[model samples]
Target: MLHIVACIKQVPDTKIIKMNPKTNTMDRASAPAILNPYDAHAVEEAVRIKKRYGGIVSVLTMGPPPAVKAIKKCIEIGADEGYMISDRRFAGADTLATSYALTKALDKIQKIKPVDLILCGKMTIDGDTGQVGPGIARRLDIPPLTSVKKVEAVNQEEGHIIVHRKIEDGYEVIQSSLPCLLSVEKEINEVPYSSFPNMVKAARYEPHIWSVDELEDVNIKQLGLKGSPTIVAKVWAPPKPEGGKIFEGTPKDQVDQILSVILEKNELFQAKGGY
Candidate 1:
């Protein structure tokens, strides 16, 4: 059977998140955490592939203890197993450090059962850098396919997968060998509602939790904040723009004001095919 691992994350629901002014850090307690939206799609895609190709789908993540909520979510989505790597040392990890920790866990998972493929979201909403997927693939010495829009075909016997990778203008079809990493777009698949049985299973799901000490071949210097070279210098919200000026007076005056403003930026209009 094919073996697929979907790497997912629990992210603060940024839609309702608030920022702390004193420390410039997110007030995570103010917002509920949920599985990363794009990662949800990645899990959905992995489940679909398993249904089509016959595989064991395992979802993996690195976060605090509460991150098990995200793993159970993958179980509801049809993943057969879930694993989490959590420890105090993993706190304040940048993408590089985060990827290092994840790669170590993945290596350990590989020892249990060789992985045929790995899946991930295009990017985390919180980070938005889209680097960790490729970083993990690099560490594993596998090809990295990013921004995948669809899976065109998978030939297990031939040991290859074809995908539509989104580009600036359109998408390109890429055929990659097995043991590859894919960072998928949200548009790749629509997640189905969990079945009642799956819901029950998710509720009772117990994920394998590993700490830094439990992971094999871990370097003390590469497990967390100490391993991160990049540091946030500062963070602050951008200044809000001034309110728009009201065009009052006559209808003709308003029309003239609009025309004058348009004329001032005539080049922009021309660039957009305006007369």
Candidate 2:
């Protein structure tokens, strides 16, 4: 049976997030916690794959206990199983440290049932770094395919999967062996509304929660802030742009005014080759 693993996250709603200047951290209380948008798409894709291929779709996340909500969200989306790695030691982890912790959990899960494929979102909206997925792949020693736009095929018997990976101009088709990692773009799939049965099942579903101690062969130093090398020295919002000048006049007059303004910035236009 194909066992697909999706790495998901519970991130604060980016729309209402605020920074804590004093600690260089996010003001978690400022915004309601929600499933990461990109990860939701990953979960949807995994569920679709499960439906098509007849396998188990498992979702995993690393966050505090409240992150159980995110796991439930995956269940509602049709994931068969959910796992969460939550512990005080995992708090304040940067992408690298977070990846380390996640890989450990994945290793344990793998012993229980070998995973055929791993999926992740392109990036988390809260972090926006887009590094953790590839990081996990590196730690797991698997091929990393980022920004996947479509899943072309998953040949389990042949042990390979074909995908369209997004590139600068358009996309590139990739065929990687099974057990590879895929970081998917949001355009890959649309998450559909949950049916009544799924909702009811999700309401009663409980994810397998693991603490740092529960994870095998874990390095104490690599689980949290202690292992993070990149430090946020400060967190602050950038200055908002000034409002544009509104010229109120006839169409011809407005055109003349715009021309005058452009003339004043002719040097900038020339420098940017916008002339």
Per-residue error for 121 in candidate 2, Å, reads: 0.6
lDDT of 2 at 68: 95
Which regions of candidate 1 are displaced past 4 Å?
240-244, 249-251, 259-275
Q: Which ten residues in a row have the lowest lDDT in candidate 1?
A: 231-240
For candidate 2, the per-residue lDDT at 254 reads 97
The lDDT values for all models are 0.93, 0.93
Cα lDDT tens digits for candidate 2, 98-191: 9999999999999999999999999998879999999999999999999999999999999999999999999999999988999999999999
Model 1, span 103-135: residue lDDT tens: 999999999999999999999988888999999
Candidate 2 clashing pairs, residues 3+ apart or interchain: none
Superposition error at 222 for model 2 (Å): 1.2
